[model samples]
Target: MHFTAEQRLDGGVLERTFTLGEIPGILWTPASTSAPVPLILLGHPPLGLRTMYPRLVDRARRAAADGFAAATIELPGSGDRPRWAAAEQARADLRRAVAAGGPVDDHVVDALVLPLVEKSVPEWQAALDALLSLPEIGGPVGYSGGVISIGIRLAVVEPRISAAVLFAGSLVPAVLFEEARRVTVPLHVLLQWDDEGNDRRAALDLFDAFGSEEKTLHATMGGHTGVPQFAGESAARFLARHLK
Candidate 1:
């Protein structure tokens, strides 16, 4: 992995854009730190990072100000990468099924999500390894994102991630709940209670399935993109508690 660009921000934070093979990402680090700092992995929503630029910047800046390093990588088929046709087809099919009020088949759900999990987990793990290898980063990492399933997979398999702040925005593919049962890290989940596209029942079920004894569900009223400012503050505190 190599940093392609670097800029020095106010208060000595280092802003960098880098790539590890096919994966492209941006990183924020506090400047002039003598020791390695905590790191938080950020996951983007379906709209991609460009559409959510403010949110990503806010979270990354907050993490950096809180003495943590934060980074966000482009998920499969996002960024400038050519979109994966199979995943795109599956998503289109699922949308049509949803619009028609028809039941989506289990196999179809698996097809839409499993390959993403298969590809994303290792990429995140690789990114983590590369990020941690840098002199400015250290242990007790955290994961934060609206990509709920990718968060679940990493929480279950990545031993380096000590905690996660998850946004429960999507209807989880059923099979992922089983994987949720294996997630042992502390979690702070944010749920917008009135989100139109979310399955409240499924989000609750997924939360209940978490294996971590110290997990929280912070539900507030809003749409999918309307998470309250206080909810973010609460998640930041959770990250500090476990990651600091």
Candidate 2:
């Protein structure tokens, strides 16, 4: 029951690393553990920096206090890891689009985008599987991501997952939406009003494609980041309803 905290952004948030078997992840959790709890796995945007966002850490910490364990994961090649030019190109394209700019003209960006997407999915799936296997996590699983939202969708469709929460991301290659239609678990999607990459319409289309009997969609004012502000309460409700 011991932990360490790395203060960041003038103490607004702290990056907490937790040991999961041999694999360690930077996460935010409650200081005290009174019960076995559900978990929220945060899938981050494809940022080159490893610094954990203060708002995300705050949201995760709050979720843990509310009887859920929340953790944000740093994808491979992101944050404290060596960067690849290909990855950087892909990230730049996303940043440009977010600024209301046109698509990146770099061919390298286009070439690396889908490969990175595919690579990250399996890594996240393995991370979730390992987390669920832990004895301390007794409740269902949920996820939220900006650029990585589609990865969460791919992970949740697996039989092991009970429920999922997605933010500002979508299934890609267009065909995955068809696969999403077959998922039986309850899914809640949070959409942003002016999401540059995956806008509201895209979220609506995915929701319609889900075809889940228990799916729900909600909207918020802030763009991608706004969705996680509700991570504590909104996810709690979904996990309670579905995890049981």
Score each candidate by Cα lDDT.
Answer: 0.85, 0.59
Q: How would you encode candidate 1's per-residue C-alpha lDDT over 1-244 as one tens digit per residue?
A: 9899999877778889898897778999877677999999988775666776678878888898889999988778876767999989988988887788776766667777788888988999999999999988997899998678889988888899899999884556776878899898889999989987677887888889989999999999989888889999999999999887
TM-score of each: 0.94, 0.73
What is the overall TM-score of model 2 with all chains considered together?
A: 0.73
Candidate RMSDs in Å, in order, are: 1.6, 4.8
Model 2, range 1-244, lDDT digits (tens) per residue?
2234554433233345654433346654445555666777776565532455665666565565566666655565676655677767666665665576564343534444466666666666776676666566765666654453354445445555667766635424454555567766677766776665554665677777775678777766666545544644775567656654
10 residues in a row with least lDDT, candidate 1:
45-54
Clashing pairs in 1: none
Candidate 1 segments exceeding 4 Å error: 101-105
Task: Flag regions of model 2 displaced more than 4 Å.
Answer: 1-24, 27-31, 93-113, 226-232
Alpha carbon lDDT of residue 147, candidate 1?
77
